[model samples]
Target: MKIKIIKIVLFTLIFIIMLSCITKILQPKDDGAIYGVRTFFAQNNNHNSDILFIGSSHIHCSINPAILYKEYGISSFNLSSGSASFWSIYFYIKESMKYIKPRLIVVDMYTINQGAPYPPDFIFKRFAISMPLSLNKINAIRMEASKNVFHYYINPLVFYHERYSELNFIDFLLYKGRKNRYKYYKHYIPSVKVHLQNEPNIKSIYDVSKLYYKVEEYYLRIIKISKINDIPILFIVAPYVLSNEEQRRFNEAERIANEYNVPFINFNLNYGDYNLDFSKDFRDAGHLNDEGAAKFTRYLGKYLKENYDLPDRRGDPKYYSWEMNAKYHDKDIYNIELKQYTNLNEYMEKVKNADDYVIGITMLGNYQKNDRVLQSIATNFNIDNIYLKNASYVVDNNKLIYSSDGSNQYLFHKEIGSYTDLVIQNGQRLSINRRNYIKTKNGINIVIYDKFTEEIVDNIYLQKY
Candidate 1:
């Protein structure tokens, strides 16, 4: 009897060791925060976020929190996922609130589709796994277990494994470094140029009835939570190059917004005056590029300033980090140049005289900083230009200026004190101190210099007209 008991114990020990080996093999390598799992976890723990924007990829690509901060002194973060559903939004919000108490919540209505045919289970799974904390992990596990007990228990190997099969060993291995991890409280400011245009097939719409029901539940939950926490919720329908079906979805969303007593801004219908170029402004058909985001954010900032009683966290030491982030993200406006005009006076005169003209202003890669400069210029200039090219440029005092670029020539105006560097003969070259600028076969290179240091800032490529 003693020998038999020992044999049984030894066999059990060996089995356990084998299981452990298998588990380790399946376990994901932790490289750093860029890893999807790590990024999700790190973002949830971000404490400096004062406003949380949640939705699908649309929310992530369109709303630049750093831009918002730069313009209005509002701290915000984007808590969105690709192909995110209502359940995902809800869980993200629930998890996010644990780390930061936001002043406002912006919920994009794109995911509130009522016609999608897929089951909510898949959506729930996606969101559940995205959560990083232990409590959220446990909650997600329980939820999954209740629905698929066999998969949860019998398939332990499969259940515990990370979902990113596309990531190779190197990718996972690289993420193991602590430096690769995302800074939990850090804010990202986008510097890439964005273009806004109408997407092809601006009339397609999809029925989201089933999806709407699920979304409705989450929306109500968010509203309830916001009310209890004294946080205001703003419902925004991000503009996209839409099909007829998608346009219809916005109409339905408007109806739902009224029913829910939520303030809704449907940019698709309201921002007609902007005459956006969807192709240039979007990363895809649905998501805005940096340029589009800047335009939309500027509109939002002005709207908030005019309509809402939003707090300006500027100069408040408690929000010093946010302020610093904004400043750090701010672009030096002197560098931006309008490649189309030959002289600052000419550009200003064209801006004052023309009913419509395209203004192309290039920034030094920071979207938020560019937006602030553009806003300043827009507020100050009387721009009647038809197509505003690039992401950042503003009309002021009946003259258009490159507000975000830091080049001294662009900042100085012969007539109006200082304006953007002049583009001679289209984009051939800029006439900084020179009056007659010419473009070579290789094209005109407008080299802008710094003001205080006199260092070469940036070169603008222009074509001779």
Candidate 2:
């Protein structure tokens, strides 16, 4: 019996070794370094952060660390991922706390909704690569690690393989062999362009019963962990496109928030009175654009100043990055162009005064059928020695003429017809043609196109003017 027991122990050790070797072989090619970097940051004692924000894309894009430092004098870092789950959040917080002692923890509560499931791909990748052998990570790993060793070990396809495809090796080499940083906000800004008037009345995309149970279990565990660690927890619901079902989910979240004994700040519900423009402030229905992020950050800064005891760490040399980041925020010249035109009259004047420009007309839905609006703008802008470039699409009847380059491709199914609508007012047609184009739309719209030759990129919209 003793011999058999010894043999069993030896077998287990050998199995573990083989598993570890296999995992490395099948690991993701691109984001493998990301996991390594995250682990390094978590374990390293050199860098210390005061405030650490963790959550999904909402946390990363919405919370600008520079803004926090500049406005409140509080140093912060956003350690967030797109579609991060409860398990991921718990592990991330655990790992991060090993390096940084945060005064406050802002937890996004959107993950609690039944509709958003814990992303298994990310959780598995994080577990296999970076997750420590502690009780927490081990438990999580054990729960997610595939039972089929062959699938886990030999199949490189099982991992997040697409991440490797997206890598730009040139960019990576230029940046000292580090992977390119994913731009969380490509164009949009976070701001309260639309206000939430009444209690959010959202409908659930998932089954209410199942979602409530899962949320309760996950939330309670998080609360218990925070309580034991003496960490102050702030629950936040980031802004998103809301439907009746989503509003219902928020209602459920509110109940859980009260029970958890944490401060629940529903930015989605509270920002109604702020008069937010949906186009200028959001990158998508759920995420904020840069402008939106600034507004949200300012509001959050004010909130922290009033309610929290967070200290201003601006003068400290250790927080120099914050200052640098703050300076870079204002370098975008597009914001200046937007401020110059408050109304259509001002916009028209600027267009008239320009020498050479490109005019792009975007039509929504069926607007392409009626080219009245864009035709009129084209006629009005007709001047000698001036260029009038026009692109039109159908959105029912309203033809919108946008002055930009032809390269601005739509991401959705919008009929974008690029044509130079010349109005010969003073004999010479306006020369509205340019090789370079600046994006005017605030939000990121997904353009659909033909699969084979990649023809006709549609659904592109303008950024904030």
Candidate 3:
């Protein structure tokens, strides 16, 4: 009887181990907003985060923790899930309490106008997956799921098991080598795409109206939770082109804030304070691009510092992660700005001094002898004979790694990150990981590949006439 009982226990342990491994392998690995937030939050052991930003996409895209730390030394985290309704956010706050003890909670009011009682399955599922297994998670799933709560979300494998076929080699490896990829992300994922918008002119309606009943209930619950924990909470409506209807809803949000004595700020009405340019700051009417987010975050950081009792964690060894995170965030900004340069001389100047990038250059067709800017760039790459029919060069960390002089047909291959192939035939052809980056047919073509991001930053051409 003793031997049989021991066998049963051993069998159960083996089965559980195997199940956990399969579940991890089957789960989708690339949802940054979902997985990144949960993983980073779990990793924050210092519990030094003084503020927490929660809400929909607005919170994640608009509030940059890196900039907050860099500018004001305010320790914070964007513990937000995209498209998450207040129902999920309430539980997110509850789950987060298990880890960090924050002094303030900032709620993004963008989803307050959403009329749905529960968020859509796609949004709910991501939020649910982002939460760790606990009593809070179980309760959240039960309330959020219409039915079959135990079957669908109790174990994510039911939904993700089919992804067994999608599993790649990286999935089996622990960490999946993504440690450095999002190190600077800090749960703040800003959109790099830009969309110009005409400045919106909308006035808040004076008539007081109530929020959607379910939204009001959850919002009140969030306020009550903060009060119970003795943590202050702030509500913000991040800047976006607003319509009359949306402004009315936001006005309702303000009324709630007033009633509860919670601090609230509507950025749509106060865009000028941040010098927000409608044409340049937004990725869309609904979201801010990187530039806009940085501006908004800087303003918000200053406000938090002046108005709140948040500490400056900069230069503190205990908050070294925040400093490192800011560095990585700056690298992301550098990558974005590098692609916007059109002047070859200015572009090369920035490139030549930066040792972190792997640079590739190929000269095609008759060199523009009269164009001094083009000639200067060629000389920088050690193209001694600009009069030569063709030349190709590769620079790693500002050192000449490879060069092909006077060769019309030169095939140069190197592993910048993964691999890069530069072939100068009739015209210069450059590709990174098989993605062609030939911007112009004939000119001095240069490609910048960032070693840190392991991706091509930009491709420029000094067109020769």
Candidate 1 Cα errors over 4 Å, as ranges: 1-47, 114-126, 133-146, 149-181, 184-212, 273-275, 315-465
Say which prediction, candidate 1 or candidate 3, comes out ahead on lDDT.
3
> In lDDT terms, which candidate is top?
3
Q: Mind giving the per-residue lDDT tens digits that candidate 2 earns over 1-465?
A: 999999999999998888655444444433322343243354332244566677766776677766777778976666665556666677767766666667778888666664433345554465445444455555555444545542442243554355455543232331122222222111112333443233334432333323455456767777777788888888887776766655556666666678777788777656654445565677667777667777787788788778877878888776655555454343222223533455655554544443223333332222232344434344445521212233332111122233223223322222322321222111112112212122232321222222111122222233422
> How many steric overlaps are in each model, in order?
57, 56, 0
Sorted by lDDT, highest first, which candidate order results?
3, 1, 2
For all candidates in order, the CA lDDT equals: 0.52, 0.50, 0.76
Query: In model 3, which range of ten residues has the least summed lDDT?
Result: 418-427
For candidate 2, which ten residues in a row score worst on lDDT? 424-433
Q: List the candidates' TM-scores in order.
A: 0.54, 0.55, 0.83
RMSD of each: 15.4, 13.5, 4.0
Q: Lowest lDDT 10-mer window, candidate 1?
A: 411-420
The digit string of per-residue lDDT tens for model 1 on 1-465 reads 999999999999999899755643444443111133335455434565557777776676676655677678776666775666655566667777777777678888787764443435544444544556355556545533455453553354665555446444333332232222233223232434545454454433444333355566666777777778777788887877666665666666666667868788877766545545655766666767667777887777677667666677677766665654454333222223333456545444433443223233332222342443334334435434322332234332334554433332333333211222344323323354354333334322334333221223344444423
> lDDT tens string, model 3, 42-154?
57443778898888888877888898998898988787777888788888888888787788889998888788666777788787667777888888877788775557877
Ranking of candidates on TM-score, top first:
3, 2, 1
